[model samples]
Target: MTDKIRGSIGPDGPPWPVDLLADLHAGVLEPNRAADVRARVGDDPEARAVLAALDAVRTDLGALRDAPAPPMPDHLAARLDAALAEEARRAFGGAPSRPRPPRPAGRR
Candidate 1:
């Protein structure tokens, strides 16, 4: 497994971390860094395999969106509800008297 990772390294530096590869595949990487990663992995069979696996996972998760979701078990739902209520009480010092105003949109 480590060897497969090392297989992607170029003369410039160490192997690209799997998380960066995942970000590249997900189109979340900054443009310049994404391009650099692509250039490094373009000819490496191992890196290509990693990218293929990420693609398959993305496809599988997408397919799940169309599938009917299972209902949570009643007991589990009750426990989860209790937990969330407790958290809300702790965080806000009890139930809020009024709903919070919506946050303004856009980056902070």
Candidate 2:
């Protein structure tokens, strides 16, 4: 996740600003407020760049949301499985009798 945010793997590369997630998330929560924030960002070069990076991230996320699921690396899949197991344990008061498979990739 850090590598992906740092642009080490995906397009947009490292130096891609991750701050856009906050802005985009804000937009998701309150579109009018997001519009106000976006206007402010337009006045600052750095802000604009961050917004652009976020737009790229949003685009990629959207593509994933729209596409079919794909295979995931073993480590990541295992990590997700473990987290879900923890969550399930917390919810159920006991370990999952059996480990469940990882969720499909792509968007939720």
Candidate 3:
């Protein structure tokens, strides 16, 4: 269970969204919805195969051991942090900070 979403090809329609199948596979979908998808997969060979393939991939991916995450490059990390801060400020309707004007020498 990585947070990856799995998609499914519907019997006659376009593919269903990833979360629908992922939730069903994870047993998190409401029982009725899970049963509906299960029934559809059971009734249609192509749909069943699609579900199986997605399941297989999920199983394979889950079996992989996680490697230690390396440190982010300082430059990239700084840029990312700055971008996120800017985005948050904008989201909260805050303007960017302005530099203060230089004071005259006579002013203590």
Candidate 4:
């Protein structure tokens, strides 16, 4: 298991870190590592609590998937478009200062 999975122990509480438990709940860990984490979590009450909270969040988010997303406000959309255009200009050398003459037909 990676260091990220094997979270550090603290004197205060929580044998496993919230992120580690979340990863386990999300099924993002490798099979062997996940099994190890599950075994450890089975014996830890705090870890179980964290997993339960994560499960609730997952259920809520899953429910949202079936619901329609809220529309982006017009003002926010305009701002985002302007930002993206500016970024494109910066990335592609600012859209040629002026339009170039059209190339002759069939020219290489």
Give me the displacement of residue 52 in model 2, in angstroms: 0.7
- Cα deviation at 84, candidate 1, in Å, is 7.2
lDDT of 2 by residue, 1-108 (tens): 353443543322234334443545446636765665555545556445766766788899999999966667767777777888888788989646466565566533
Q: Which residue pairs clash in candidate 4?
A: none
> Model 1, 14-47: lDDT tens per residue?
4655766777898998898888878988876766
Residue 64 local lDDT, model 4: 97
- TM-score of predicted structure 3: 0.40
Q: Give the runs in model 4 whose Cα sits over 4 Å from its true position.
A: 1-7, 10-14, 72-108
Runs in model 1 deviating more than 4 A are 1-14, 75-108
lDDT of each: 0.70, 0.59, 0.61, 0.70
Residue clash pairs of candidate 2: 6-14, 7-13, 7-14
Instruction: List model 4 lDDT by residue over 1-108, tens digit each.
Output: 333544677412456777777778889998998988788678778788878888898899999999987666655665666777777778887562433344344332
Looking at candidate 1, the ten consecutive residues that score lowest on lDDT are: 99-108
Candidate 4: worst 10 consecutive residues by lDDT?
Answer: 99-108
Task: Give candidate 4's TM-score.
Answer: 0.54
Give the higher-TM-score candidate: 1 or 2: 1
| C-alpha lDDT of residue 79 in model 1 | 65
